[model samples]
Target: MSRIAKRFAETRASGRAALIPYVTAGDPAPDVTVPLLHDLVAAGADLLELGVPFSDPMADGPVIQLACERSLAHGTRLRDVLAMVREFRQTDSETPVVLMGYLNPVERMGAEVFASAAAEAGVDGVLMVDLPPEESDDLTGLLERAGIDPIFLVAPTTADARLSHVAAAARGFIYYVSLKGVTGAQSLDPAALGARLGAIRAITELPLGVGFGIRDAATAGAVARVADAVVVGSAIVRLAEQYPDAPERFRAAAAELAREMRTAMDAARADAAPAAV
Candidate 1:
């Protein structure tokens, strides 16, 4: 089984939800990105999404926009991000790593080239915000060939027909955007997200991950009640910005938050099943 699928199955068997966290590669520098990833795993992150800075991050809010800008200014490229992933995988071969970025860079690198490079770097998935499901065949085919998942996002405003399309294209899991706006937006309502998640669940047996506007343990636990995975991005990335030079500090900040969320989700899951294995 894929890393994400196996992890989710273990989480279910243990009566818990998966804790997925995000950080921008080369934000402060690649030096910080690699070690920070190790810290996240040590702190109980089931999966990690490494953001590749882009010129135009339409799906990201100001916080993430600034993060991307910093990463770009530090000479962060898709190649460098992939290199970082390769380095991280020498030790962390179990946790799934997802490349979160825009299509411009991937297109510039070419579909087949990027997919092969990502697989060599030990990346398990890619999540491009602007890439629509209708236009994902080439990348999907390449990633599937390499055993890499291509995750897609669905918003609260998504049509049911499109949900199935996305579900079919997406591999690891479908990221269910809790709000209508970009990442880090404040308006998050679980009701509509629950409805959309239910729709997605009806179509695909793949795990459904929810993100955006999730700030802490309580929120993560609340979402864990329904979703198979809880993705927390902006808040963790923001902490990395504060400790750019010290990778351990950056990792500590993110890992600490992830630990809290993971613990909460585990606690919440116990109400549904037995103890962890």
Candidate 2:
């Protein structure tokens, strides 16, 4: 299994939700990305999803969309992000890194070729936001053959058949989008998410991770109560935006946010455990 799948399995076995933090790989600068990644893992993130900046990030709201613009302005590219990951693997190979991005760059590189390059660069999994399941068979097959998982998204409004398709196509874990709008919009409802997630759970046994609109400990803790993982995306990306000239300061704040979320989730989980007789 990929490290992401393995981590999810470990967390699920322990009855806890994995904390996955998303950071745009070259937002502040390429030199700062790896250090911030290490800081995020140290701050309690079980996995890190590095977003490759694209010209148009359709699924993202203003925050992450702006982050993409910043990274692109900083000359971030898929190749650059891969180099960053390659360098990152020099010191750490155990912390799962999911390269999340749009399909344009992957298509630009071709399926098999990109998969091979990603595998060589030490990428564990991928979450291609715009890749449809109907057209992802070839890429997913290539990634699987390369020993990398192809993580897919399932939104709250997704129909049953589409959810089943996502369940069938997804390998590492299902990324359950907790709300109806774009990424970073704050209207998440955990009880509503749990109900939507229930149907997807029936379709497959893969761990379900909810994302989009999770910004703080209270929201993360609330979502952690149901999902196998809580994905914090724009919040982390915004930290880079918030401190464009000071990546270290941004990382410090991000770490504190992650630590708080982890603590809240752990405490809630501990409280949920049945009392011994």
Which candidate tops lDDT?
2
> Over the full model, what C-alpha lDDT does candidate 2 score relative to the true structure?
0.87
User: Any idea how many clashes model 2 has?
Assistant: 0
lDDT (tens digit, per residue) of candidate 1 on 1-277: 8887878888777666888899888877668888888888888888999999998998899889989988889899999999999999998889999999999999999999999999999999999888888988888899999889999998888888888878888888888888878888785666666666787788999888999999888888778877889999998978866876776777777888989998888777776454323
Report the poorest 10 consecutive residues by lDDT, candidate 2: 268-277
List residue ranges in candidate 2 displaced over 4 A: 275-277
Residue 150 lDDT in candidate 2: 94
Distance from true position, residue 154, model 2, in Å? 0.4
Lowest summed lDDT over 10 consecutive residues: which window, candidate 1? 268-277
Model 2: residue 70 alpha-carbon error in angstroms: 1.2
Model 1 residue pairs with clashes: none
TM-score of each: 0.94, 0.96
